[model samples]
Each structure stands twice: as structure tokens, then as C-alpha cells.
Target chain A: MGGDLGPRATVEGTARALQSQSRLSACVFGPRALLAAEVDALPADLRVAAERLTLCDAPRVIDQAMKPSQALRAPRDSSLAMMLASIADGQADAGVSAGNTGALMALARRALGTVAGIPRPAISTAVPTRAGGRCYLLDLGANVEASADRLVDFALMGAVMARRVDGLVAPRVALLNIGVEGTKGSASVREADALLREFAGLDYRGFIEGDGIYSGQVDVVVCDGFVGNAVLKASEGLARMLMERVQATFEAHWSSRLVGLLARPALRRLKRELDPVRYNGASLLGLNGIVVKSHGGADAAGFGCAVGRAMQEVDQALPRHLARELDYWRRANASVACGRGVSGADPRRMDADNPQR
Target chain B: MGGDLGPRATVEGTARALQSQSRLSACVFGPRALLAAEVDALPADLRVAAERLTLCDAPRVIDQAMKPSQALRAPRDSSLAMMLASIADGQADAGVSAGNTGALMALARRALGTVAGIPRPAISTAVPTRAGGRCYLLDLGANVEASADRLVDFALMGAVMARRVDGLVAPRVALLNIGVEGTKGSASVREADALLREFAGLDYRGFIEGDGIYSGQVDVVVCDGFVGNAVLKASEGLARMLMERVQATFEAHWSSRLVGLLARPALRRLKRELDPVRYNGASLLGLNGIVVKSHGGADAAGFGCAVGRAMQEVDQALPRHLARELDYWRRANASVACGRGVSGADPRRMDADNPQR
Candidate 1:
């Protein structure tokens, strides 16, 4: 009832995901009647797998167009909020939804709160690269007005996620700016550059331009939400237009159409490799729980990818590892973290003297 | 002497351009000895046509890495400065350089000044679209921190360029923002949208996102320099990456390689259609004289396109038309123009009592 495809896509995606991960289980949150029909339609193998799933009866739906504030006031019986509540109450290991991004972020923040030293969570996802690889890009639209301090925190959390989630020991982290030159970006970006350089456990690679987003030279790219959202959407729009043009050109004349038939396999491979749906899941990094946001318009396979991502995070104990890492960094760098004009200064730095962090 | 390929590419491109435009002539600015050698190697027809060429002996060259401020202090004996001076003195109808962008913009502004009501000129160019067409995009790197009023000025200037240069009457104009939603971008974008709406002569289409730049949905896209530069470079980088990947995939397998052989003609057509060099010239808009900046690394064919663009602008009397239009807009909407706090506020509106524009 939450996504564009409603509960059907979510339930079917869950069934598909269950085939890959035997240990995983789900608590489906949607209107009970609709959820049951979707579940009943699952194949025999998945029907047996459905024995592991719990259907939490949530009748009301949160529409995609609802503003975050308006969605926040939605009945607790709504699927999205209830799904998040399950994670908050420790009844579920992780939560995944294909709901509206802003409303989802707002609800996730209110339900789960921030991890220690993180003022807010950032929306992050992996972007495919020409090198036949991918890089983690963060703050996609979470914090529109991210402070220098928040950017530094994103670098720390993003690096941790890359190391834990992507299996890299030292991820090459970069701050996204208008130009690669040191003098190119806003004051906050320059300051974030300085702050990242001071972090000992992180591998900060200075600045990367918008074009460098897909260069595959770095593992993690960080920026304020405004720039990130613009780059991601713009890249998607351009890629779609180029592909459409190529298809049109290939079909224009009989000669080209003959060649197009020959090139079909290679073209299909290219399309699959660059499909945005393959990288549909956006992690709400810096949150206290494991949460993944699927694209609202994503199909079953795309939403399954998001579900698979959530399953992976739960297996890795991502939130626990992140909390431990944040506590360790603040304790190690308490002196340098103090006296900065930066907002959302590390709480763990203050608590370091108390020995509770 | 200026671009990456030095005097050879510039000289050769000029020779090629001379072949197409019978009425055209050139004043070559470089080391007299090196310049003569290149010209001497031109085709027989072009050599005789050299009678129309003037070789100015400027011994110094501005390096691509030179800072704009440093380049400003470069000797008057340098090729870049000399070329611009030739335009300023009306010896050349327009100037084209495959030199450093920052340096070119700085010198163009200093030598030609802004048009009557424009505070600063914007760096603008046409980007190819899937519609088998191109649209103008501006402030590629000119004004990084544009105010709302400056944005309004950009809209006016961009519209004039689309109309006069692109030959479109009432060219649809839009302000590039993070989102199309009226509340998405910073305060300046919203205000610029409002200002654009009041201009009856212009076809204001409202806001477009970064992805819309190449959508061919609007005739002109205006943005602050930072976002514009990032988007332009990012698009270039992605296009290059995708093309490289396609080539790699085609060559990776025997089946694909065989298909690639059959697809060669179609592929070549696609490459030619998307070639960045074909759209290489970037106009320095809102300036009193026509100044075109070619890619510093452009080769003969690419530089030739820039030369062709400059020639087109000259034939059309672009700057004169822009000045006339700006004067008319301010005079026609004197009351509304006065009450606006937008920067580059129409000075003509302040002088409404004066008879002359």
C-alpha cells in the first residue's frame, strides 16, 4: 500500500528475495486483505517460505505525494510508519520500503532517531561506473543544508559503511565539489576538506567534480543533498535520453536496422549494466537502525534488490559496527573535536570523559 | 600559441574555415616564425588565400594552467591578449580562441565590458539533444555566486541568444534548479522565476532540473556558474565514459566483435551525432563584442566549429540585437523593473525619464 505498485510488488519482491537468503524472514506491513491476496498468489515454494513472514495489519496507506509533515500526522495504522515502528521496537532486524523519499526520511528520523555523533541521516546508494564497478554516493536528498561538521560525519559513516558493506578496508573517500581544484566549492565544502583530512581512520581523497561521480576512481563520494540530488537525477535523465536516441537511430533506416539486430545482445548487456533499478536501494546512513528506501516506481526485481540490500545490512550488524566506530573515533580525537564553530559537534567527544561512550 | 595543440591546430582550422566562408579572413596571432611555417604548409588554394590573412607577431603564449589573474598581468605582447585587442579595436568582426576559459572570460570582460545593462557576461554554449537538435546552456563557469537579480539578467541574456543566435522567436527559457517544484531551489531561483514571468516578449518556461538540460524540452537553460559548470563537465565525463564502455563491450567477445564490424557505419553515425567537438564553441554572452571560447584541447576540426560559430554570430549582428532587445524590455516594463531588487537591475528603468536608450 506504500509504493507505486502497492503491496503486490513488495510481497512478490519479498518472495523473490527469500529464495536467495534462506535465513531471512519478513513482517509485511500493509492492509491485511490486500497483503493476504498477494501472498496467496505466491508460488508453492514461496508459500512455504511465507510461513516465516508475519503480516502486520496496516489498513491506511501513505501516498507518494504527501508532504513529510503531513505524512508524519498520518494514522499509526499506515504501512510505512508501522514498518519503521517494527524496526524501532526490535521486532525486525531491518526495514525496507518504496515510499516517498522525503516523507520516508522524516518518518525514519522520528522513529529511529540519530546514531551518536550524527545530526541527521543521509540517503546513499551505489552508482554504476564505466570501469564495470560502482561507488557509494551519499546525502542524495537527506540533508539539503548539510553543515561542514555533518559532511565530515557523512564521510566517517560512509567510509564505515563502505568498509563493512562493500568489504573495503580503506575506502577512498572524496568530497564532491564543482571542481577538483581546492579553491572551487563553497566555504563549507572547503572546511569539510580540512575536517576530513584531520580524521585518522578515514581515507579522504580531497575533492571530486560532478563528472567524477562515475569515474570509479573513488569508493565513496560525499556532498550536501542539493548537489547530490541534482547530479543523480540529471545523470539518470541524460542516460535515458541517450539510450532512447541510440535506439531511434538504430531503427531509422533498413541498413541500420539490420545492424541493430546483430548488436541486440551487446546492447541488452549495456542496458542491464547501466540500469538504475539494479542500484535502486538507497540506505538511510547514520540512522540508529538498518533502513533501505526503494524507488517508488521500481518494479518487482528492483524492489527485491532493495530487500536484498536490507538483508545484507542486517547480516553484517551494520548499525552496531557504526556505533562502535563512532564511539572509538570521538574518544581518540576528543581534543581536536572541541572548540569548533561546527554545529552537531560529536556527542561522543563530550561523553568520552564520562567513559560511557 | 594558446590552445593545447598550439599554432598548428589554430592555423589549420582557420585554413579549413576559410575554405567554407569565401568572404572570411583571419589575423593569425603567434610567434611570427612558427606561424609562417604552419601557414606555408597549407593547401595551394588556402596559401593563395593567405593574401587575406594577417600574421601578427606576438611572441608570448598564455599557458592553460595560468591563473586568470596572472594571465591578466601577461604582457600585451602575448597572443591571447593581442587577439582580444584586435577585436576591441574593431579590426576583427569576432574573436575565437581555443585558450584557457577563465583567462578568456577575464580578458573579454576587461577589453569589451558588459553590454549596457548587464552586470557580468555569462559563458554559454549549445549542447546536443536526442531530438537531433541542440539547446543553449549558460554561466558554464562565469558567475559562481549569482544573485536572484543576476539570474534574471541571465534569463534575459540567454533568451536573447536563443532568439538572435539560435534563430528562435520567443525561445522557451528556464532557470536550472535542483527540482522543478517551485519550492525546490534556493530563494534566488524562485525570485528569478517570478521576474521571468513578467517579461511579455520572452517565452519563460519556468524551472528545469539538471537532467532537463539535455532533454530538449526548453530552448535555453540558465543557472548559476557553479551548478552549470559542474553539470557541463559531469555530462562530458559521463558521455565519454559511456562511449568508452560501449566500445570495450563490443571488443570483449568474438560474437560482439563480429557484430561490431557490421555495425561500424551506424556506430560512426552515432559518434558523429554526439561529438562534443561539433558543439565546441561557447559564447561569452552579454558582452559588447562577440567572444567565443573553444575547448583548450580541441584539434583542427573542433576549433573549426568554434570559428564557424563566431562567423555565424558576426553575420547575425548578435550583440547589437541583444542590446536593442534589453533596451526595449526595460523601457516597456519600467514600473515593474524599478520595484525589483534583482541585481543588474535594468539601469534603463532608472533612467526612464531620458529619451535615449
Candidate 2:
């Protein structure tokens, strides 16, 4: 509710989502008067869908500059905290927000908590691939610089998302590295690659360069949050630049503009297929209750996509699935740690044999 | 000559460049007989241009999989070594190679050496920007995990390149980070920001996020080789994917096909501007002699662009300029270390003052 565009985009998005997804019911949280004004402005065709949308009053707003710590203290009336409380208290199946990312994650983690071993939740989203499919990229901004073990945690969560959400049997997972060679990238990514190779139950494809993320070869691409965020934002920037350049090309001459009109329908289809708004939602994985984060600058259509993501996560019961998966992963790794012979990297053998050989 | 496309593209590219740049000459390196065969088969139109080209015999070829260390030992007959030797021996002003990148760097650094303060050379390239200008992105794949000091060294080197090669005064330099906020990114980037702030003689902008690289507001963007290489390769891949998607959209329907025919001219113009081939050269900055690395997969037109970059660097006397700049930097930093109260962070007053205040 406190995003850059405030409730105008969020509430309108809810009405749109309600119209398209007939079963979805929404609890829109904001200042009472502002929320009422937006809700009252819905069009006539959406009157029946508006019946499923409820507005809840809140007195305070968590602005972007407020630190997560400052916002967490006695946040009784904030929209973000109230929305999470609804999910935590079992009144709502899932939640979606366009508010401050730091405050949202902090309040959601505090309210919903994480699965047994994961310290915090990760942000996972789908990226369009060259083959017209999706690649799930994780730790988008959840952890600034993840440790080797934490990257493995992201890999596990991302894999489960690809499996349960996309229905892949054994999603091919890879670590985003500078090079595909064994000795490349930061120490954390290198160490994570080694750990994933031995860990059971996941199909661990080897290292992948950033370009490979869009090659349709990998089902999940995992990286530290800084690199992940950089890649996603870089792609967004490049896409925007390219789209603008293409438009400028058509409008540069009247002859091309006439041709552009003829190609308009196909061009529009292409734009819709590649638009970031259509793929707006990013799931906060590891939380007990589902929480999807919409991009802060997302428009009404984009915010509607975020709502759709929350609905899908609710239907799949994603948090419950993740908890079960993590339970299996922990026991499996625990056994691998207990038995020296199982890993094949036994130090006892290394003493007598050349490690490289 | 040892690149993926081999000498077919390299030799053809040399002929093309010589034709266009009448003053340019080339030494084509390969096995004696093979080099003669390619040179002898040049088109009639390029025969006059071919007269300015020389063929140098080389017995060995360094390959994609060869370790840089192994390539260093007795590279007497390799084409890459011969090319660097020509520059080292003062027979040529600059060098361009489509050979193995690792071998090329190791051989060039061993042959020509670096400036006073630079330990190793960095890969620097001009990336096309949204405003039709270029941004110099450095350490594209050299020094994968750059230290804070190393990043500062890159900044100094990149600044010199922008000033000399592009003739810009005080080129705006920035550290590529996850967020523009001071608290974000890895410790190395944060440390580099502090170091850059204190160092004199350059326009040091605060941190910029990944997306800002394209804005054309900054003339130079610096990052560790790991991040730089990832950003670059991801961009190349995404651009290729987008271009392919655009073509597919045009060909998907019958009516769109006629529109594509009418739009072909403008689209062709658009492709040429955004094409990776047109931006082939990545200068090995900090080296005493100029060396440009071409994309291994580049065609003749692309390899020709690499040759053109080498020519520009030769004209600029980049290494000599870099040496002078580094001298000034070392002296400035040495004085900063000796002076007190000049930096505003005088530690002597710590007993009476709170650091934050």
C-alpha cells in the first residue's frame, strides 16, 4: 500500500485480479479514506468482482527510507504488518505487497517464520528464456552475499519451486559463475558447486555462465543476492533500452512508421510476451505462509500479476511443500556428513593418494 | 589465428580492414604455407591492399583449453607470441589477436610488461549506450576477484583510457554495485568507493547499480572481472535472444512477412547499431604495448573492428599516458598518507568526538 504509486495501483490491481481469477478474494489494506476513494472508483463491469474485495483501514505508512529495524518496532497499524498478520493468523491463504522490500521481508519473517533450518526466506522469480520457457532465478535481493551453504539452501528452495510450480520432474540446477570451468567465480559460488555435486535428491548440473541463464538449459539458476540482483536489473535496463531504440527506429521515418502500423499487432504480442509487468511476482520462499512481493514500480497490470502469483502459491501450498523438502534435504545431508565413504572426498584416502588424481 | 573461427575470419578481416583504412598494414601469422595460401587467394579488389600485408610463420597454436601457464613456457613459434613480439621489438605499434584470451593476456604481459603501478593488464571495452555514446567497462575478465586496491587501479587505468582513447576530460567513473546506497554491495566495492573518494584528479561518482551502466551519464564503469564478465556475457546473450525473438515475431505470420519486407531497411539499420560484431575489440589496458582481443566467434567485419581499436590505441600512446597518470596518483596518495586533518577524517580528534557526529 505504501509503494511509490500507493494504493491506486495496488487496489486497482486487486480488482483486476478478482475479475480474472474468479475464486480469488482480496483484503486491501491502506488508510481508510484513501482506500475507500480508490475502491469506490471501480468501473461498472467490475462491480460483482468488487464484492470479493474488502478494504481494511490502517493509520501508518512504512516509507522506503525507514530501516527494517525502525519499521519493526511496535508496527501495529502498518499495512505490511497487518497483511502478514492476516496470513499468520490463518485468516488469509497468502499475501502480496508492493511496499518496502526490507520491511516486508522483516515483518513476514517475524510473523510467518521460516522452515526449521533456513535462517531467512529467499526471493525467487521466473525469467523468460530464449526457448519461450521460464528459468527460476533465486536470492534476487534476499541475501547480499550468501555463504556457500546459504547458496545451497537457495538452490533447494528454487528447485522445489520449479518442481511444484512448473511441474518439472527433476529440474536441472546450476550455479551462476563467471566461467563453466571448475576453478572460476568467487569462493562462495565455487564451494556451493562442490556441495551441490554431492548433495542428494537434486539434479545438479555443473557451473553456468550468466548467458546460460536464458539458454533454456537450466531449470534453476542460483547465485548470491548481489549478483542475482545485478543480472536481473541489468536485463531490465537492457530490455528497456532496446525497446526504446526499436521504437525510435520505427518513428525515425514515415515509411517505417507506416510499416510499423501494419506490424503493430505482432509487435504488441511480442511486447506482452517479454514485458516485466506480466511476470511481476517474486515469491518469498521459506516462509510458513506464502508472501509474494510485487516490484515497487509495477503498474496496475504488474501488481495484478503479483496477485496471480500469490493465488498460485496458495493453491500449491508452497510453504508446506518447501518444509517437507527441506526436512528431506537435512536428513540426507546429515547422513552424508556422518558416513566418510559416502562423499568419496574422504580425507583418509587423500592422505595416501594425489587429490587431483 | 588460434580463435574458434581460425584464420579464415582473421585473414579475411585483415584484408577488409586494410582496404578500408588505407594507411593500416598487417602481419598475418600462421604456418608459412597456410598463411601464403590464404593471402594468395585474396580477392582482386583487395590485391592492392594485400600488398601492404605481411605473412609471418608460426609453428604452434595455443588453444582454448590450454592453461595460461603452459602457454607461457617457450611460446617461441606460436602466432600469439609472434604478434606480441612484433610490438615488443618495436616492429609494430600495436597488436590484435583472435586467439585464446588467457594465452593472449599471459603472452602479451610477459612480452610488453605493464605500467609502473599496475601488476597485470585489465580487459577494457567500449559498450554502446542508450544515448548513442559509449561507456568504458573494465576488467572484463582479468583479475577475477579484484581487491579494493586493484579496483582503484582499474579505475585509474580506465580513466586514463577514456581520457586518451575517447578524448574526454575527467570521465565520470563509478563502481558497479548492487545498490546505489552506500551500505550495499560487497566489502571490496565499499572499500573501493572510499579509496576513489580520497584519490585526486578524477571525477568519482558514487556507486551505481547494474542498470545505470547504460544511462550514458557516467563515462566509465569499474567492477571486478567476475562481475564485469558476467554482466557482459549476459548482455550478449540477452541481446541475441531479443534479436532472435524479433525475427521470429516477424516470420510468424503471412501478413507480418510483407510488413517485415517493408520494415527491413530500418530493422537492418537497428541491427547494425546494436550488433556485437561492430564492437569487437576489448583493449588489454595497463600493458606497455597495445593489444586488442576480438570475439572468438566474430566474422570478418567484427575482426576488422578489433584491428581499428588497436590502431586508435597506437595513435593515443595509451601506455605512456597511463604511466604519467599513475605517477601523479602515487604521489597524491603518498601525500594523503603523510598529511593530517586534510581528509576531514582526522583520527587524532577521536577522543573528544563521536565518529558519526
Q: Highest DockQ: give the candidate number.
A: 2
Q: For residues A1-357, what per-residue lDDT tens digits would candidate 2 score against the true structure? A: 766788989988899999999788889987889898988887777778888999888777787777778778956788888888898888889899998888898898998777635788889899899988999998888788798888888999999999988889999999988778776678898888988888888999989988998888999999878778877887888888888888788778889889878878878878988999978999998887889999888988899999999888877778777766665665678654333222333333422231110
Per-model chain B TM-scores are 0.92, 0.92
Alpha carbon lDDT at A164, candidate 1: 90
Candidate 2 positional error at A295, Å? 1.2
For all candidates, the clash counts are 3, 0
Cα RMSD over interface residues, candidate 1: 1.7
Error of 1 at B193 (Å): 2.7
With a 3 Å backbone cut-off (N, CA, C), the pairs that clash in candidate 1 are A211-B234, B1-B7, B149-B343
Chain A only TM-scores, each candidate in turn: 0.91, 0.92
Write the residue-wise lDDT of candidate 1 on A1-357 in tens digits.
Answer: 667887788888887787777888888888898889999988787777777777899888888778888888888878889988988888887899987777788888898876665777998999877666788888887777678888877888888888998898899999987667776677898888987778777788999877677888888889877667767776776788778866776787898798788888888888887888889899998788889998777877888899989877877778767776776665565555554433344545534422211
lDDT value, residue B220 of candidate 2? 91
Off by over 4 Å in 2: A333-357, B333-357
lDDT scores in order: 0.79, 0.82
